[model samples]
Target: MFEGLKVVVGLISFILVYRTVTGNCNKYLAFAICAIWLRFFLAAFHTITYPPLIVGFSINALGSISVACLGLLVIPTPVFTLKKFFPFFLFFVCIAISGFVNMKIPGTINVLVKWCYFLVLASALILSVRVQGQNATFKKLLVAFTMPVALQILSVVLGQAKATEADGSASYIGGYNHEAAFSMIIVSFIFVVGLIERGTLSFRTSLFTLSVFLLVLVNYRTSILTILPIAAVFYFTLAEQRLKPSQKAPVMMIVAMVLLSSFLALSFTMKERFADIGLLLSNLDLMLKAPIYFSDAERDIMSARVYIWSQYIDAFRNADLLNQLLGFGPDSWKGRFNLYAHNTFVSYIYEYGVLGVGSFVFVCISVLLNALTLKDRKLSKILALSFVGFLAMNMATMPLWNIEGLIFFAILNAVLIGHKKSSKSRQVSTDNRELLNAN
Candidate 1:
């Protein structure tokens, strides 16, 4: 509820400022900053709480309200097709069906509600992207979205100084657990938004730089260790191949240094024991077998998940031909097994069976291809990095299953899928028009 309050206030503040700016757009951006700041704080603070609730509706409310705002903004002016948003609507329908079919579990209804919240967030973000113009509104949206990174930085600081030294602390930060997954997902969102906004305004670029610094402090070792190096290599190689010779050297140098510095800083902080890899690995090997690391009690909980997954697999495999095609129903899984799949892919398979999985895979591939089609060399590189980094982060932890992570991924996919080929085209058109008039 505390978190819910923050979100509600943030949205009201943003709406008030949006009204006050009188079309300035920049003031509206300040409102976005406040909203995002509140969101990040709530998400970071609540990561440890089970069945995370909307304590302060502020974090949850803004996205839904913002979607409505986008709808209103675009209804008066025609920037993008409202129909382009239909696929997203279809995607949510699938999620709803999945939830209802699996409703037998203890908290299945709550999960569905959370799913609805995430869908609203995804819609809001996608709508915001669609409504973007040369106007300042889109920039403000990105600025507001970046606010979460600030909260992550604070969490990382606290997490670093006093990480939990026990196993149930799976949700604690900088502890090589799931919290790191959430942190990395939020950082990836910030990183991509920064890249997109780099040329928008000097102030925005400065904010981008600040975001990078804070991201370093947020220190999710797995993502930092992988994304930094991969992004650097991708940036330089892609830039060298794509940009003009004159434009290559400067960008490469700047990107390289930022990635390197961030990588080193994060690595040093979270992985002090990794300072001695051989010893750390040997100790980790023993730790895995120790009572504290894999206690009987903890093992039992994990084993229960295994049991649930097994039941899901058996149910599907043994289903008759028709049931296999249509699926068991959304709430069916919860009723049948008393558990939600902790694994996202498993969850999808349980709900939709093969056909649903196929459709999901199709959407994913479309997003990937769309990202590849991005013409802006910089935006292209950023999306590529995010896709790879995000996928890797999700392997060990359930980013897709986490509400915050779901919003982050869905928004990111929308950005990648809906991002228009502009900036360069607009610049060239402006230059050509000026030349013709001069002649």
Candidate 2:
């Protein structure tokens, strides 16, 4: 009976995906995003300590390989759409180059596969929006996104979280393996959800926003930097909609007060995080430059991020000119230190070197600029703000390094690409109209 039920559910899901993509877009990109919820669901089993279970590893790589193979199927890539993100393409090229130079084929292929995943996923989503229409596409996205997040929250609140901090504190990551990635996803969720449902702060919206603040209060304090500005934008926009021009200042004050109050109310619980601010400020210079080595005493500070980042920085400083410009290679830090760089920028500079990090920064700048010029001004403003938050995140953690961060981006960017071209979707046969030309 259980096996039959599994097959029935699989069939239903397959049918739903088929209808959603209109038989043109392949299923894996959507399946991968859908699988993210599954990853978190599997985390529940990991949370079990009674007998111990080893669930499947993340499917992000599998998803990437699957969609990337679409290129092998002769579907032309959306080269036109991808041109807008050419800098990112350069970043990928740099990674592959660094890998070949360093002779790390597995590491090189891994990053390349993820890039291909993003490429094909973006193409598929853009086609879905064009074929399924904005409301339906976003509705499907909302449901897909909402479940994992809600389940994650429930897991944390119930104390089933398997994630912990370097200092052995509860991170409240719930189903996520890391707190920073979860926090980044929260930021993305706010932006994407708001994009789908825009209006004054309904009771539900206000409550959801408050819940996010509370959740962050208990874990990943740095995320607060990104959340504050983005949340303020959304909340203040409500003030604009309802208040008179003369009342704008007071409404802004109120928004600030609301955010402040949320922080203050939870201050007692996050005393350690607040202290980290002082720790970082006091050691600002050392944080940037130090010897490639630290004693055990120094390694315990700032959750060892200070020591961890310094090793990466000092190595980059001492690297040969060629490696300095091109980077040592993908995941090179792991071989030396047996650890990932806690800071994304620091990691990129050491691993991919100047060319890789520069291309990444350029991509961020170009995307932000183009976001403003988008015909859909509302989406432009929200997404640009969200991207800022995402950047703030990258300063401390590698949001783009994880699958959750990529999922929301693929959705929002797909909307940005297809919303305007929606008219052209009607030009071809229903079957071929929204087809992915995945180059």
Which portions of model 1 show Cα errors greater than 4 Å?
Answer: 1-23, 26-90, 93-138, 142-185, 197-230, 233-342, 422-439
Best by TM-score: 2
Question: What C-alpha lDDT does candidate 2 achieve relative to the native structure?
Answer: 0.63
Error of 2 at 151 (Å): 2.8
Q: What lDDT tens digits, residue by residue, belong to model 2 across residues 1-439?
A: 3223333444554456446445333353355345444433333333342232234323444444555675335334443334565777788889989899989777787677766656655666666565555555554544344444555555556666554565566655545446666676666566655655454234646655755654473477767666766676676676666788898888789888886886676666677656665777787776666744566766776677777888889889888998999898887776598678878899999989999999988878887887777766656777788778767767766666765566556665666665653344446533344354331
Q: For residues 1-439, what per-residue lDDT tens digits would candidate 1 score against the true structure?
A: 4345335544654464455344544322333334344444445434443342465444344443453354344322221223434454455555556545644333444445555544444444443443444224345455444334433444455554334323322232322234444565446455544444434655644554565555444444444443553346444654566568797779778867876786676566545523433343344343224233443443443323333444566677677875576466555565566656545555666676666666666666665666778887666666666666766555334566555565566556656644555754544333223322322
Estimate the lDDT of model 1.
0.49
lDDT of 1 at 144: 44
Instruction: Return the lDDT, model 1, position 308.
Output: 46
Candidates' C-alpha lDDT: 0.49, 0.63
When superposed on Cα atoms, how far off is each prediction in RMSD?
8.7, 5.7
Cα shift from native, residue 403, model 1 (Å): 3.8
